[model samples]
Target chain A: MTALSALIRRDIRIALRVGGGALIGVLFFLTVTVLMPFAVGPDLALLTRLGPAILWLGALLASLLTLDRLFMADHEDGSLDLIVMSRTPLELACAAKALAHWLAAGLPLIVATPVLGLLLNLDGTATLAVALTLLAGTPALTFTGMIGAALAVTLHRGGLLLAVLVLPLSIPVLIFGVAASQAAITGPLSFGTPFSILCALSLVSFVVGPFAAAASLRHGLD
Target chain B: MSLIDLANPTRFLALTARVLPWLAGATAILLLIGLYQSAMAPDDYQQGATVKIMFIHVPNAWLSMFVWGIMSVASLGTLVWRHPLADVAAKTAAPIGAAFTFLALVTGSLWGRPMWGTYWEWDARLTSVLILFLMYLGLIALWRAVEDPSRAARAAAVLTLVGAINIPIIKFSVDWWNTLHQPASVIRMGGPTLDNAFLIPLLVMAIAFSLLFITLHLAAMRNEILRRRVRSLQMMQANQKAA
Candidate 1:
């Protein structure tokens, strides 16, 4: 198999075998969504209004949970070294890892967002927007996330540090993600504006983030 | 010969020491002038004496970013050319950057209270600057957290370069969004809109702050090099004793 396919498959198998990381992330999202409505009371209108932001925030926090694991395990067991030694370029390897991460953590949260969105009293448009934005923007979370994971690979306790380091950088994602979702519910903004910006951000991340991660991994290896 | 020769730490140290006094003097002189001008500058017609806060606030904010840019370039040097001094330069700049960031935040809040009727607002420029401060703190903390100095330097260098992305976002957030913060007055498409009196003092403060940053960075780099030497000497002595 090609390196890309092989890497992707390996990650999928690993993700399935472990099972808990993605589950925990989605469960965290659900828990936050579930608990927030209780705190805000039965004001379904308020809930609906906040639905997109709540969903986006949940997704942000969820993705943050899985970030430390992205590189730490491979780094610890020396698998990272082997991967670095592989003929495939580090950027490709980074993409594979980020892609797997999105599939594993981001995709699950996205799939489960509708159920959570409904709990928040979202209408069909908001629900669809929340799901679609998460679908498009989660890749960005994973992509830019690679840079954070790569930087923190050598640290002993990187979980909290990774969140601190990555969260601020992810603000643009949060801004556009929530804006896109909210725009979907509100008046005249077609999906094209925020959606296109989100996609552009994702594309920029997909291209630049991998190369930066590659550089970081090389630095870590040294 | 001069270029290649300075690669020697000893020569670099000697040259820096020789230059330090002059840089320090210039910084001191500029700061004196900046403070005097800023203190005497007339109050804004709209803002009253509170406008004076801009002198310190703007300079500190500019240096906060200026120091980060310096760190980013130094980091690139460290990562790309493996310049031994570059890591020292980057590491040394982090805390100074953090200090400038803190000063900017505090002064900005102070300025905001008198002008905006509140101490804090989630204005784009403020929010981004606050984030920049956090990034500086994180980088400095990361540097101190790692046990091995070399490894820590590399980690912090990577983090600095990555965090450079935030600078533009902070600068442009006001322009891109409907931020509460006022748009560019000093740096618009046409020209600076401020009166000459305020503009001159602001520029002087900026130059003064840049000099201050340079002086501090040079001092910090010299101290870091000395610290590293001391650490190596201590390690060698321990090894000899063990032998």
Candidate 2:
């Protein structure tokens, strides 16, 4: 438990400090959402209707922006080898790293949702619903993305490869996250159904991600 | 013969050599017959000549799924049993699978233009298949991205398994979302309700496509094995020179 906590703490500190891409992800999220009103035009009604989707896409891209470094920094500094060789299981270490990534990178995107939602002309309730769905959905993105990050870690210039690999896997999360938010904002359908499924996706990825990432990391290690 | 026996690269090569000609001959015959049958079949009352696209579209769609199934099984072989040819099988199959998937998408779009009045729709089925196509491309890219063959194989195997698990979820989610495409008319509980006119040709084309995949897969695997041999020999010569 101490080892896992320590690992998580170290990762969070590194991500929050200078050169950490966590802030970059947030800034990217802001840029994507901010550009929406201008490119999409000044129609408030259209923007409001499109708000949840825009926010979700921003969050997804933001997470991707930060995810490439999940293992790259450690792999470069040789700490990844130590972590893999440590008494703590590599799977647990991977999960810890992913968890830290979500805290530093994903959490802020969710937090920024309401503010960014306003740019798209979304009202309070709609913004909240979008925020709520993003909160549920982004962990699935982070964890599943960890597999891509690990697989690409040993490659030269693997950031683009990571995106290609991770983006397809993330479609379901995007679908459900947007669906749940849409359900909440405008309703013939119940929000609970998609929301539950969204949560289930996160839970499933939480279990599968660590194992798959660890396997790829171990395989990639020389 | 046991799988272990076939694991010998030379034996596998010899077996594929014997099998390839027969497979190609059968594929050619089946494709010719299937095309003849499809061409002769009377036009559908509703869709008219455009319905003929089904012959090509359905088989490619089926092959898209079929090839993924092959990759998943080979992935299991790579990860679980560490079968010598498994990664080769998985890697070699990806581009062929991607080609089929591309064919499916393009043909589906062509069929859609005459039927659904649009070349593309955000319909769940179309979206999911597009995702599947992207996944195939990603796998192929990953195979090239990694430097080490063994490492690439293992990484790609893990990815294939991950994709296998995602496939069911993708199918289910797409089903749950609004389906713009027609529901299963061919594979449903009532079996195929498709007319014998369409059914027979469809089956033949499907068989042809499957045979094509097998023949291509075997040839590609043989090439991969030879590529590895050349790589090792080159490395050996370089090492000797260095010494």
Candidate 3:
């Protein structure tokens, strides 16, 4: 437990320090959300309807942009080898790293959503709903994106390949996140239904990501 | 020979070398019969001749999923069993599978333009299949990007297994969502809704396509084995010169 906590602490510290790129995800999210209004034109009614989707899309890409940092830096510095060789299970270590990644990277996107949501003309409740769904859904993105990070960790020039490999797998999360927020905004169906599924996706990813990442790391890093 | 005997790449290559011609012959024969049946089959009262497109479209769609099924099994072989040819099998099957998926998409679009009065719809079935196509391309790209063959195979094996999640979703996408594409009429709870005129030809076409895939996959595997041999042999020659 202590070892896992230590690993998580180290990762969080690295991500928070100068040039950590943790804040870059939020900036990218901001840029993407800000750009959408220009592309779609400044029609407030249309923006309100499109707000949840825009926020979700920004969050998804933001998380993806940072996901490679989960393992690439560790692998490059040889810290990943030590972690892999340590007494602690690689799966747990992977989970810890992903958890740290979410804390540093994913959480900020959720925090930024409301501010970005305003640019799209979303009201308080709608912004809260988008933020809430992002809270549930972004972890799923981080965890699953961990698998891609691990798979690409050992390869040369793997950044673009990471996106190609991971994006298709995240389609379900995207669908559910957007759907849940849409339900919260304008709903015949209750928001609870899609929200529950979004939570389920996160839960499922938490289990699967660690194991798959560990497996790929074990196989690919050699 | 038992499955174990074929685990040796040399024996597998020799066996496929002999079997490939016969497999190709059988594919050719079955394909002829299927095309004839599809041609003779009556058109839908509503769709008219465009219903014949179903004869090609359905089978390609089925193989698009079926090829992935084969890759998933081969992926298990690569990851779990570590069989010698399993990596080759999975690697070789990807392009053929991607081609079938491409054919399925193109043909579906072609049929849609005439029947649905548009080239595309963001219906669940169509979108899911498109995702599957993108995944196939991604797998191919990953395989190409990775430098080491063994490492590439393992990374790809992990991906193939993960990507299998989309297969069931594609199969049931119509039923799950009120999709523009029709739900499963041929494979459903109450049995096939298709009549004999359509059913027989569809089945024959599906079987032929499956055979075509097998023949292509085996031939591709054989080629990959030979390609690796050449690569290693060239390395050996270079080492000899250095020595």
DockQ of candidate 3 relative to the true structure: 0.03
lDDT of 3 at A8: 87
Residue B81 error, candidate 1, Å: 0.6
TM-score against truth, every candidate = 0.52, 0.55, 0.53
Residues A116-212, candidate 2: write the lDDT tens digits: 6755667778989999999999999999999999988866457889999999999999999999999999987899999999999999999999999
Q: Backbone clashes per model, in order?
A: 0, 0, 0
Q: TM-score of each model's B chain?
A: 0.89, 0.92, 0.90
Q: Judged by lDDT, which candidate is best?
A: 2
Q: Each model's fnat?
A: 0.00, 0.00, 0.00
TM-score of 3: 0.53
* Candidate 3 local lDDT, residue B63: 90
What's the true lDDT of residue B6 in model 1? 71
* Better candidate by TM-score, 1 or 3: 3
